[model samples]
Target: MALDRLPAYVRKLRNAAGEPVYYWELPAWARPVKDEKTGAMVPAMRNGKPMLLASEKLGSDLAEVHRKAQLLNAALTDWRKGAEGASMVPGSVEWLFQWYRKQARFTSKKAKTRADYGKLMDMLAARETKKGAPPFGKRRAADVDAAAADRLYEMLRADTGPRQASYAMQVCRLVWSWATRHYKVTGVKENPFMGMGLTSTAAKGNRATSRAEYTAYRAKAVEMGFQSMATAAALCFEGCQRVSDAFGYVDPDAPDRAAIVWEGYQPGVEITLVQSKTGNPVTLPLFEEVPGEGGGVERVPLYPELEEELARSREATRSATGPIVVEERSGNRYVERRMSNVHRRICDAAGLPKDMTFTGFRHGGITEIGDAGEDDVRPVSGHKTLAVTRIYNKANAEKARRIAGARRRHIAAIGALDEARTK
Candidate 1:
């Protein structure tokens, strides 16, 4: 390939190992020199080394190599400008983002959360002020008021979907909140993304598994020889727990024993653990009438059907410990995605709606308890707040009417008893 035809400053060099490598060479002024205080060489007099572009070592195709080269060149250009003290303005959105990434608020996020936030940041970085204006990242942070934020949110929702737009707004709100408390950035008295009423266009996930639907799905699972999946479904509904927690059991010998454990079964058996997502401690009873407060018997019954399925799973696995749900072929614990596939297959076989999900079992169980006038279903559902518990309850007008009719019947029974006593 001709060097002249390639982007400027992006040249191929032969490494000491006699392999071709592409590198983006810095200008003389931008090149590293020894720091007087540290007595160490740094790239662009910064803490990093010179940029290495695509190479045969990367094993990327030609197009990907070229794309990476372009990105590296853009980053080098920014570095060179920074070296000349002519980089992004101090109070610009780009500068704020750079600072935000270094803060505890951003760094402390989980790996998955950070990755999602990174995608949102990339989307913001690619956005323009207007159709052909400068990149949104380079715009002044102070210029983003509530109205401007709303307009940007509307545009993003239209361009992307509601979920992505809502997430982006959340990221923006976090950055702005941190800036308001820490940095004295101008025109940021309050977070612009706050109280925006940005709603998700996606449908609400309020579907609950009906008893018939669950029974059909379980029958299909058994017929397909996926007894483990049937066991998982039974646990989710009877235990009133998420599928992840129901199937996340690990053996004592496993490396992640500290994170997940399979507590052995006994009468009034319960698995006491902290939820992975919410960190809420929950005690899931495997049988009815577990010991309750003040020596009163609280009914947390394990249905006969669920009990039978669990026994079948135990007999099939032939193990007293380890994950309750395992692939018959591999005899290994099911990952989250595999468990999801099991649910999807069962749903398909049962002729259930596509939107019917494994989580709906928990929702259905919670709603059933709620309909029975159980004031507290949080112990079974492990919801952190009553509000969250209520969200899972899918009771509608029909359920309300049934409860009203039951109340009237009870009142008539009381009247009959009183008239008989008077006579």
Candidate 2:
């Protein structure tokens, strides 16, 4: 296209290398403005560098050039219009969100966490009073009472389902709490979301993987050449660890190698590491030997099944160090989601219930130990409290039945003794 045919402020210039470059120059009347998406000053002209026109690279694509020019013009116009719009009203939900974003509670979160929360905030911002009314975010914060909070939660639940509704409610509760404590806005007494009853409809019960399920899943994984999945299952089951901690890795050469590495094959030895989620230090015994009833010999605690899986993984990676669970094809370390997908696939092949997840291995192992009346599993599970461990104990019903049977037998024995003494 000819230079005269291009829009105003669209000019071609020569670089230091004498190559042609095209960029848009903001009008002299327009001042530097902040771009909300990037938090950067726009109309960037430093070092003779500004927003490059895609059309310049497209060559003879006149249609693409026109589209790019239109988009750039529209963006500039929108920025100018937004700058002239009304400012956020104090005590409004929008104002509170802006203030909350600056607080340590929100700012201290990880980038991914903040991004996830931002999606929920966007959802809340789009929610209208009814169907075509103003957005809920524009409503005054003080106008939200307990009933209003409940209604909003109900709406969110109906729209997005319980998990997202619960999560959104949690974010709102945090902001409302911060506002109640910090913001001195009048008519704002207590946080309406504080005591709002928002329960998750997500399944409360996690199906524990049975011994049969574990065996079947492992066999299927090995048959499919997914040794990493088998290794992950063993790690969670034997170590009583969460999937994240089970698959966690650090540089093999790092000083923290001891925390993740399993040393030599000593029978009574244990592997020590800190739990990734709870940060609680845990020592998992490598073996468990129990004395036979006949007192023949002491059993060795060597976990041959787990050892085999670990050895298989090590052979696959050809490394003495690094993450045990990895992609079979690329030998890349597995992220949590990727590992979960592998687990799901394995479960499908094993014909296991849909509710059985990778996490169930940890819960099942812990529950099995609990069923055996062994409190030592707590050290391996790395639960902060016995209560937390009990929560994972799905063998409570069986334990209760066993206890009841034992009580009945003891009562009968006492009655027999009393009758014998009377005779």
The superposed Cα distance between candidate 1 and the true structure at residue 88, in angstroms, equals 7.9
**lDDT for each residue of candidate 1 in 292-389, tens digit (9 for 90 to 100):** 88797886434556667877877887877766667776676664545667778878878998988888988876666665565555555566632335
| Candidate number achieving the greatest lDDT relative to the actual structure | 1
Model 2: residues with Cα > 4 Å off, grouped in runs: 1-95, 108-116, 138-148, 185-190, 199-202, 223-225, 249-259, 262-301, 328-333, 383-423
Candidate 1, superposed: residue stretches over 4 Å from native: 1-95, 108-115, 128-135, 138-140, 143-148, 184-191, 199-205, 219-229, 249-262, 266-302, 315-318, 325-351, 370-423
Which pairs of residues clash in candidate 1, taking residues 3 or more apart in a chain or in different chains? 288-301
All models: lDDT? 0.63, 0.62
How many Å off is the CA of 329 in candidate 2? 5.8
Query: What TM-score, to 2 decimals, does candidate 2 have?
Result: 0.58
Q: Which consecutive 10 residues in model 2 have the weakest lDDT in total?
A: 47-56
Clash counts for the predictions, in order: 1, 2
- How far does residue 112 in candidate 2 sit from its true spot (Å)? 7.0
List, residue by residue over 82-103, the lDDT tens digit for candidate 2: 3222544667776676567667
Q: Candidate 2 at 257: error in angstroms?
A: 10
